[model samples]
Target: MRPVNATDRTPADLLRSALATDPARPLVTFYDDATGERVELSVATFANWVAKTANLIQNELAAEPGERVALLLPAHWQTAVWLLACSSAGVVADIAGDPSAADHVVAGPGRFEDGLACSGERIALSLAPLGRRFPQPPAGYADYAVEVPSQGDLFRPYAPVDPEAAALIVAGAELTGAEVVDRSRADAPGLDLTGPGSRLLSGLPYDTWDGLSAGLYAPLAAGGSVVLCRNLDRLGEDALAKRIESERVTATAR
Candidate 1:
């Protein structure tokens, strides 16, 4: 693995580099057994989503660097977009914390009621098969599908973010943007993510370090891609193996 100057670059920077290298390579493939949903995004497509999401965060929500954005989501593809959006906007992602304390909250259908308790701005995602617009949006919350499409495909933060700013608060641990980048670079080799073509099958939940590494950080750091599975516990061993074979997954973090 190459040494990264974490003090100079954030996770979003790494993703941009990856996009430059191979825009057509698959960056994320998501699976939801319960919903029979499967979505694949190339680097360019994923980056487009990230840009729109970041624009939403910066322009609509007016979230600033170091602000906390609570993410009440599963290991779905849209969840990954939100993660990168927060990083790109220099907002701290809170995956396992009190939503009410966050400056902004993004919630899925099941967590909509709990998200309403948050005093900050809220965005609700239906997590529909095609990421469809919420049929009946909550009274006060913005619907992600309704707003994100109108945002710009390119994103530029209002101000440059400090690498030392807090970027994530997950599972009782706070990590700066620099720390997150450094750890992702360091963890990639150990995770057997050596190059761009490497594909990782991750069954881990996003709230844990292992999950974040496999699902987002490690892949981006190594210029690789991820196959993220939600409700993976429902898959039988045979089914799992078939998926690994079909997706051509080279590594797994479960």
Candidate 2:
């Protein structure tokens, strides 16, 4: 089989390459101090979640290419899965954006009511410690845990995704799928994120380019892994340093 060229690949394609290169390597580690939660995912495991979530978007929600999906959640591992799922399904991920303008909305419990108000279909995620199903699902929304499990483990988009089509809207800028890939490729080396395994610890919000780069794109582009921290402000300096030491974080993005 011919090897795929990196320049020709999308951000989603980079994830597949990461899985192929080292399926057992940790792709993401997440911590939420307020919730006292910690979770880690290997490349293969992360890719599986992405596939299942993509199936939910494609099969159940009937999300078409170029559709907009509003992501109303925090810096959780599942949020990473949703981001990749949107890319794989060719849907634009609107991170913490106005849900009213979306074709579909995925929200955590804190944003569930607002998500329901949107005219589009909704997927509610508990974002519970282990990504558990909601105790009581909202009347009209699909519970991510309940529905995503039965979906196919493999995903193929119903139509070809145009790399030039808008794929992300964040921090008041919109980027096409190809632009995201190009930018990540160009910026990764400069960010000290190049990897055959770099480990990055990031305390950035997902709503901005810097945060997205540190938390998602950079690591994927460089074949590195990320330790994404939420409620980082709540952690004392000593605790933070200990986390870095234990996780073997090679770089810090604040």
Candidate 3:
């Protein structure tokens, strides 16, 4: 339910934009994918979570601005929050995953033929399980942890985000530049997913146009959140319900 307008804003713009005018609305509903239980996150609560998560990424994870980050996560609620927090804090979420192809296959934009490449800045991250003990941070990371209680909304503002600055780093070379905000739209519905308030439940990865845009970007663009479950055990309905119930997500693309 979006009006036709020039949407140059990244998925991050959504929650803040909504918070600017509507902070008390029911912005998220965590539904148990299996049992169908629900927990709604008010606008203020969602904003708080985003700020806290963003702080963890920026301060603890040392996610510098404009850096390309690779998110290797299965479809669930946490993935959505990670994406939105990154967007709000100006961290590029260059999501990567395998579609319905072989385990060795991955998503690609085939832009290497366009004559562009990485500028020697690349990071790969795996959002490990909070269910188990923390795993080692990927290469180049300074420290790592599986979970941290809310960093809270008591953090500082991040560096100014250059709208066109690279907000992503996927298979496409130099994924996105500071001058390419206008072109973030994939010219495909699947690529223009949504922002917070929406729900995208899947046990798959966020690599395909549908998964990335609809699942990650769409909800955030709409001032909503994303939920990425491990999708382990193929994600039964009970697990999905738990995420939705905990997050209080409303709409969903998947």
In order, what is each prediction's RMSD in angstroms? 1.5, 2.4, 8.6
Segments of candidate 1 deviating more than 4 angstroms? 1-8
How high a TM-score does candidate 3 get? 0.56
> By descending TM-score, how would the candidates be arranged?
1, 2, 3
Q: Please, what are the lDDT tens digits per residue for candidate 2 over residues 1-254?
A: 12335544566888878877889999999999898899999999999999999999998999899889999988789999999999999999999878888899999877887887678889999888898887899877888999999988898988877888998999779999888877877767776876666888999999888888889888888888999999999999999999999999989998
Q: Which residue runs does candidate 2 get wrong by more than 4 Å? A: 1-4
Residue lDDT tens for model 3, 170-209: 4554444333233334422343344333454433355564
Better of 1 and 2 by lDDT: 1
Model 2 has an lDDT value of 0.87
Task: For residue 205, give model 2's deviation from the true position in Å.
Answer: 0.7
> What's the TM for model 2?
0.95
Ranking by lDDT: 1, 2, 3
Taking the tens digit of each residue's C-alpha lDDT, what string does model 1 give over 1-254?
Answer: 43453443788888788787789999999999888899999999999999999999999999989899999988889988998899999999999568879888999878888887789899999999999997789877999999999999999998997878899888989998888888888889888898867899998999888899899889988888999999999999999999999999999998
The best candidate in terms of TM-score: 1
- Clash counts per candidate, in order, are 0, 0, 54
State TM-scores per candidate.
0.96, 0.95, 0.56
lDDT score, candidate 3, position 98: 23
Candidate 2 clashing pairs, residues 3+ apart or interchain: none
